[model samples]
Target chain A: MARLVVLGGGVAGHTAATFAAKWLGKEHEVVVVTPNSKWNWIPSNIWVGVGQMKKEEVVFELAPVYKKAGVIYKQAKAVSLNPEGKDTSDKPFVTIEYTQEGKVGESEDVEYDYLINATGPKLNFDATPGLGDGSGQMGTNTVSVCTAEHAVHASHELEKCIQKMKDGERQKILVGTGHGTCTCQGAAFEYIFNVEHELKKAGVRDMADIKWISNESFLGDFGMGGLHMKVGGYVVSSKIFAESLYAERNVEWLIGAHTSKVEEGKIEYELLDGTTGEETFDFAMLLPPFSGVGLKAYAKDGSDITESIFAPNGFMKVDANYDAGAYENWKASDWPKTYQSPAYKNIFAAGIAFAPPHLMSKPMQSPNGTPINPTPPRTGMPSGIIGKAVAHTVCDLITQGEGAHLHEASMAEMGAACVASAGKGLFTGTAAAMTVYPVVPDYDKYPGTGRDTKYTFGEVGLAGHWIKHVLHHMFLYKAKLKPGWALIPE
Target chain B: MSIEEENFQKNDNFKLTMLPGAFAKRMRTCVVWQFIRFMVLNIKMLIVVSKSH
Candidate 1:
């Protein structure tokens, strides 16, 4: 049987494995290797951080779901790839170390006819001093909402801070990216406002001070360099929209900032204007930057060919123009359409596993030579869409033979809808719902803003919170492989 | 004022803040208005999702 192995089971890997299994049926083998046993619907983790939802609400067991889909699921972390096998064999295999209950640390090599690398980000917390425990995990000084467990911890910390506020002791709260290269500023943005709302609900609004710090050169640059949204019959930049929200809610901000260090109750940061400062807080929730999970590759002679197959950052090399140097020379066409590795046709990468050609934001560096800019965000809607497209191509290759046409889902051609929650109450809650077309702006196609403002829009209200809540349940249901799940759009 | 507050004040963001009017703020949570908005917003999102495929 033609075996297909998908590494990592986040949004991308899960979608690819499940769809490929259904399409290939009993004719082919589909194996999914993921370190975790549970599937987490990440967006809802923000709600979990505010105690609006529990950890169990955002995550579900992956074993049962895979079983129901007639797919083999291996609870293991992928270590390396031997794409050229050994000197005696031409077949390819991936080495995986089991993290499963009974087989913890047990290593095995599984041969594959095709491979998909969707290992996602390593959550490189150690990129900044004191941001990590030095063992590749979050540090003790601050909390995180990146995972369901992290959100649970963050919720408890927030509760303690609120209790201190209730006792008439003032507290300062800070939330944003921990490192300059961090993505997912949206999560931190949602969290700070939620904390503010909860403090007010607890009758301690005056006792708490909240502030935002991000790597974005300006506010609302949720990495695709910010888009112009048509709001109230006028096209307004996200910078204005975001500033309005922050100002209205009495939340202050620090932009063009790279959080350089984290210590007990204080953080040192460097700004774009070559200035450095320190901010102190009683509570902090800062996200870490992402890197590849460090999967190595070897050739037939067992010589390391990792550099040929993956980027320097550890993400797999895909069908994109990597040499597109200089910001002024960048083009939308530089984005990968098929997501297939150029050197090996049988290998592919989806989601954050594939390295992008360059930064979507205008690259900037401090006078001290420290790079402080937000990296591209390859999560949520775009990740799912790319996953499904790659799955389609894999299935076609198996069924329609070697001449099968590849499917494409380039970020440059994709439209994304983001509903960023501000707070969570049925009537009192608020959120900003935004839509952007052609996420990677094409200057030649749409001149000024590089986006079609007609298809791009945003608004904020109680209605948005309801939609965000609805999506939480809808996405979970789809991930659970419920009946008619395919009918739900990615 | 604190140095941080002054740092924020020096920026031109204050001039661009679009604080909704009293009527607009009331409409944001008005059951009827929000219900209509809920439907319209979903339709808009569906359009975006459709074009993406």
Candidate 2:
């Protein structure tokens, strides 16, 4: 029986492995190798960071779930890939180091007939000085909500800041990107507003000076170049929507910023205008930029073939048009449909692990030649869609034979619904629910805004907040592989 | 026209508002309307996911 091994158990990897296991049944083996024992519903991390939800509420043990699904689960991190096998054997395998209890640092080589590299971003806190120590972890100075543990810590720190505010101390809050190239501006945006909402509820809003600093050229860019949103009655740009939110909530902003360094209570940053400055904060939540979780590849003869498989950013090279150059020249066809590796027919990549053809935003550089633009956002929706699509292709290849055509799920052709929470109240809180048809805007399909106006829509209000709450439960239930889980579309 | 409702102008790009089954796409700020809109939008989102690929 052919073995299908998947690296990483994040949203994309877990979905692919689970769906593949169900589709292939007992005929083929499906193995999942990931570092974390718990599967994190990352979108709920915003609520956890603000102390509205417990860490356990956003995460669950993955071992039991995978066991129930009849899939082999390895709590380990992949170190390297040997697609052509080792010198001792011709069977292609991957070297994985165990991170589970009592087996830390222990390793094993497991061979596979087909492999899916869904090892999502490395967090790369080291990309910005003081965001982390030179080592690959978050530093002590600032807080992050990228993980369930980090969210709990951030919530504790925010509580301390709130207590200080209650003592009549004016706490300065800074929330935004840690580096220029960071994605997930929506998460950061959600966090800053959540903090604001919490402080207001605590009756210390007047004393707290909350500020947002991001790499987006304009507010509301949220990495997808700021679509035209239908707010109120008029069709204003997302920049306008975000600005109104900030203004109405009494929060301030500093856009076009790239955080350069972080200290105990201060941060140094460079703006797109080529000016450098420093800001002090009592509480800060800075998101680290993401890169591929570096995995090396070797030939059977012990030759390093890492460069042939991965992009410069360490992301696995897929069927995308990596050579697609310049912002003005990018086409909808630049995006990959099948996500299959060009060199290895048995290799595929999904989620953030795959290198995108280009940034969705109009790429820009600082006056001093430093690139300062938000990366394209592949949020939970697109990631899950890509995962399901990849699983479909792989299943077809195995069951329907090798000549079967692969299923396609291109970002340029698929729609995504992103509901960004602003506060966590059942009826009082607010959120912005946006639906963009074809996550990657097709300039050729629709002129001017490059999006189909009828299909692209958003609104911010209490109703949006309620939708966000429902989604939190719906997605978690779906991810746990509950009954009728497949009914929940990607 | 009242100053509060006067802020809402005609010719909004989206004829559909956040509330499902609500014909009015104009600005709504009343607590009563907000409650109605909440239920409507929640139902709409369910349909959105069900109908979406």
Candidate 3:
């Protein structure tokens, strides 16, 4: 048999196609494709953007969990990467399209003797200018919980700004990162403190006004360049634990910034000492900014090798050290331990679909130059431990053949464990949780805070909102392949 | 008064005057000290998931 496939079903393509279809069962042939037919659990889409969960409590229906994990789903949407096939099929394939329901756009191809990609990111909401809708989605004048129907349309625009602050009026709101190389500023910092804990649980927290905006040059450079942590026993420094939880919840910040534009309630910005401003609001959410969901590729006489498989901010290109230039010559061995694809060693790439080699924060700009930092986040628990270490090196190179041995996880040798939350009360909630360790920061093996301050610490109230509501029902019961779901780790 | 609101009013007056009683603020919803800090933060997140695999 020998097939594999797997493209994008989020959370690192559904943890590498449900652990490579339970380690290649039924003789071999996994499939997957993915154009979403519901799977979501995205960090509880920040408690469904504050209407406190319910979008069927964080999605599920991935065609009956890939028909009980035998795999072969394909709700489609890949579009290209013939690897080296067509000059009349030497067999590599990919193509895709569909998007389900009566084969929406219809187009196929399939083939593949191993190939993973894990096609994440592409919420590039038109990169900025009015934060998208010039055809790349989002844009209805700001709002996004980053799916789950944009967190049920950001809990109905934060319930019409909490019924216009229960009729008294005074709204404002805003949140963060619409551009300037955004990389999930911890999901807009857990959605602006869960919209200030649901406008102080609807008592209209003194008529609204919220704030916070990002691109982090400071205020907890969450994009990894700010770690130290520890907290209650002391240590500290995620910019003083995120400016002491946005000043003990009065919530207000701006940080380096960059936004640049977005109208219909105003925005614009610039900062990093270059000035230029504007801020108005009444409600916003922001986010967007992540590329590579483009795909393309080809070759075997098909010509276009799509810039030798991706990156120019389109991801893919794997096996790191992308000319590890500047930023004081970045190291921790320029990441990527074996996300493979150095010209297709049966291809790989997991999570935000690969490409990195730089920017664990510390890259700023703006003096009219504008670069504006913050990019490398590769989401939650290092995208499920680099999608189960690229599905254990493609199931040991398809059950030990071309000399196996390639499972390495490397985010400079793993270790991550966030929590975040900040509101969703079972007795007035809150959260933070945290942990760090190797998450890339080695500085020549732990010298001056390149992590491991005793597995980096952090902590906050109601037991981190009951461990973020028991990791939102234990990662949606380990992504619904339930019943012990391989003892739920990644 | 803008350098990001004077560095957010100097980190809100450096956390209301140099961490006076540095946060415990009522043992974070007390419920028996947050149920013994929710079992020591789930054994420190299973020892960082057993040292990340």
Query: Which one is best on DockQ?
Result: 1
The residue-by-residue lDDT of candidate 3 on A195-310, one tens digit each, is 88778877888797788888888877878898996877988878878777777666778878889789889989898888878999988998988888888888889887877878
If chain B of candidate 2 is superposed on the true chain B, what is its TM-score?
0.44
lDDT of each: 0.90, 0.85, 0.83
- Summarize candidate 1's per-residue lDDT along A238-311 as a digit string, tens digits: 99999888877778889889999999899999998889999999999999999999999999998999999999
Candidate 1 vs candidate 2: the DockQ winner is 1
TM, every model = 0.97, 0.93, 0.35
What lDDT tens digits, residue by residue, belong to model 2 across residues A62-125?
9999999999999999999999998889999999999999999999998998899999999999
Candidate 2 or 1, higher TM-score: 1
Q: What share of the true interface contacts does candidate 1 keep?
A: 0.62
Task: Indicate whether candidate 1 or candidate 2 has the larger lDDT.
Answer: 1
Looking at model 2, the pairs that clash are: none
The model with the greatest lDDT is 1
TM-score computed on alpha carbons, candidate 1: 0.97
What value does the interface RMSD of model 3 take? Answer: 8.8
TM-score of chain B of each: 0.68, 0.44, 0.29
